[model samples]
Target: MTDSLKKINKQIRFLSVYAMVSSVLLLIALFLILKKDRITGNLTVEELTANRINIVEPNGLPRLVLSNVEKSPANLNHGKPFGIPGGNRGGLIFYDDEATECGGLVFSGRKDSSGKYFASGHFSFDQYNQNQVLYLQYLDDNGDRKTGLYVDDWHNSPPYPEFRRTYKETEKLPNGPERDAKLKQLLEPVNGDPAFAHRVFIGKDANKASLINLSDKKGKPRIQLIVDSTGEAKINFLDSAGKVVYSLPNKANH
Candidate 1:
């Protein structure tokens, strides 16, 4: 081949190589720009708005929900009904690792048909797949107000699955004796069994008295230390039937 032709071939090969390298570099630059757009380290906004917001784990498990009454999600595992519009309740609800509702803080207040004012704030934590085991509550109905902390017992008979089944069954029944009977039957084991009872109560009662009431597994208030709204203090020891077996200042002054 001619030397001039050979030189021309060499120049062509170099141009082709340069073109491939330039294309690859351009592709890499474009890719980097696109990737940068996707990666956000920070954001600034004047406000954020939503009816319901769920905060989830990396694996898409819901950890928490912030919702208004109309948008509150139902706790199907716990047999909780869905929120109704204009229910006048709203708060943050939390979920367990299994995405089951464990507890939440909720508040509601409104005037009733009798024009009586009512308000309540509740913070509760539930046992696994069960109803609330601990609750702190404030309630104002009409002019009467009470604030208290409660601890409840758990029973094995109406396990979560059974509870859910019974709840669904009851929902299908109308408001009548049949429904009442069914409900009583369902609650009998839990209510009648001494093993499952309200274990502790400490706070102001409906009578406007501050008291710490201690109960046995049988649900009998065995002891009560109370200070009435009038600042009278007393200590009482009670029998299983709750008759004051022994009391300071006796029954008359108490």
Candidate 2:
């Protein structure tokens, strides 16, 4: 090849290489800036409401906790990633940890003049039930949202089977010899103890689970299968009148 032609080809090669490098550098810079911006306002109210609470970066990866005081008690999972239960996406679950299950009164949602669903906490307390609700925000096919309770003739959608379950360990305690020992530990009835016994609800779920109903004999149990839990549990198996029917680990009367 002629020297002139060779020189021209080398210059063209340099220019092409320079263009590719420039394009790559520009993309990297863009990504970094977006990353910074993404972190600034990452925690949305939708997350807290749906109980699908989580933190994400621009790329949708989980957020790291700088310290405990800054973290909501709900976010602490003892090393598991923010594994909110709506699968990889997320979900909305309404609940009231302080309410009694007798009549299901506690609710969290925006209540408008017509008592339609808005964005607010309008909890009520029955004689024994407390009006309180927690919001869950999660990303689903419908995207991020805040779910709430259904009040007196209030308009609300049906429950999401995937987001909540109230009953604790629904299947029976497996009466056979295999599970007898462990079942005894979990089902120790509070026959006459002053301390109330309870099966706690702990998870991202919001649906009220099946109650732990005792058999005709006070201490005999009937396990109603339901989803996992969400960390707010009181110790009591309420009667039809919202009083304690059975408690775990029946205490000895002094």
TM-score of 2: 0.27
**Model 2: number of backbone collisions:** 33
Highest-scoring model, TM-score: 1
Model 1 root mean square deviation, Cα atoms: 5.9
Query: Against the correct fold, how does model 1 do in TM-score?
Result: 0.72
Local accuracy of candidate 2 as per-residue lDDT tens digits, 31-149: 99899887664545543323324444455444421212223222212223232332221122222232112121122234457655533222332212221222222212222232333
Native-to-model Cα distance after best TM-score fit, residue 171 in candidate 1, in Å: 8.6
Worst 10 residues of 2 by lDDT: 154-163
Candidate 2 error regions (>4 Å)? 41-191, 197-254
> Per-candidate TM vs. native?
0.72, 0.27
Candidate 1 lDDT tens digits, 1-254 = 69999999999999999999999999999999878776744557799989988888878878888989987776645333433223345898888887777889999998978888989999999888777879999999886888999998766655555675676779799999999877766665555664257889999988989999998876778989999989999999999888988888776674
